[model samples]
Target: MAVIGAAVDSETKQVFDAIARSRSVTTSRLAGALITDFIRAEKGGQVVTTKAPGLPAMGHAAAHAGAKTEQVYVRLEPYYYDELGRLAAQRRWYRSAYLANLLYAHVDRLPVLCHDEVNAVRQVARQLADIGRNVNQIARKVNIDPDRADLSAFDFELVRMLLDVETAAVKDLVHANLRTWGATDVQ
Candidate 1:
């Protein structure tokens, strides 16, 4: 197998990462599923675009009735922008419209979290934050009296307890977020 790399915007990467984390899968697996879906769709004649040496001479379709268009600006690497321009030109579409459609299509095809899952994730996040704050408080007290040999053992014990709590909390959060995937702990 060959490894391929691409530079994607942070927002896009984060979205994919979140999905992978939720599903307890690697990003590569998520990407493979998407590629497989695309290939299947193309083979079934759902995707009409073809790659050739020259640009495609197709035109963009008209907007649906009552559809409103929004204007937005995006910054991209020079090479990416150039590639988008070429692809847009091939389909006889304006660059902005082509990019908008591409983004919308990708988002539309992504897996969605249910309302309950969203709520659970939010609750786990709050628990994690509270655990972090508690750890910070313990560390601050320990830092202020590092030279106290008499209390050093006690402080170390407190720190170890806090570390254990924090680690368990993090693991709980990860499990809660990905419970729907029925994934076992690989750690």
Candidate 2:
């Protein structure tokens, strides 16, 4: 690694310090990233902007809900690393998060939803839960008094309609997720 140093005005130094503090990184690291971006831009490569780091835009699968405990490190060529950085930048994610998502989806064969898709799926899940509650109540009434159970009051058609809506929502969510992941066979 080579070291590059430059002197800046007091105001510029303050701004750099503030940005480094906001990003929870050292000033040197921030300077390195800025220099790398500048180099990339000058080389006609895509320049990644500094964005607030947060969780990746992938839906949380059941197995991924636990706290991350392990870490892995791999060495790659500069070109490969730059490409990975570009891909992650396109999704507004950290390179690590992007790689982890790819492993989860491809290696684990788990479905990952984007933010909007996750919300849609959650809505469908809530609807299904409401339907389940209603069915449970009716079942309880029937179980309590099998002789005088009134079935006419229950709106079977309404239940069917709700289920249909939920099902369609789920299907649409799946298709949208697949399409977002660049799956060509989305149906």
TM-score of each: 0.28, 0.45
Global CA lDDT computed for model 1 = 0.55
| lDDT tens readout by residue for model 1, 78-176 | 999998898677657778866765653333322123355456667766766776787677678769886752444445576567667756765665554
C-alpha lDDT (0 to 100) for residue 151 of candidate 2: 96
Against the correct fold, how does model 1 do in TM-score?
0.28
- Model 1 clashes, total count: 0
Kindly list the per-residue Cα lDDT of model 2 for residues 1-187, writing each as its tens digit.
9999999999999877755654456788777877887998999988653431321212333234442436779798999999989977866788988777666555333356556557778877887998899899999999999999989888999999989988987887666655555543666
Best by lDDT: 2
In model 2, what lDDT does residue 17 have?
A: 76
By summed lDDT, the worst window of 10 consecutive residues in model 1 runs over 53-62
Model 1 residue 150 distance off true place after TM-score fit, in angstroms: 7.6
- How many residue pairs clash in all the candidates, one count each? 0, 0
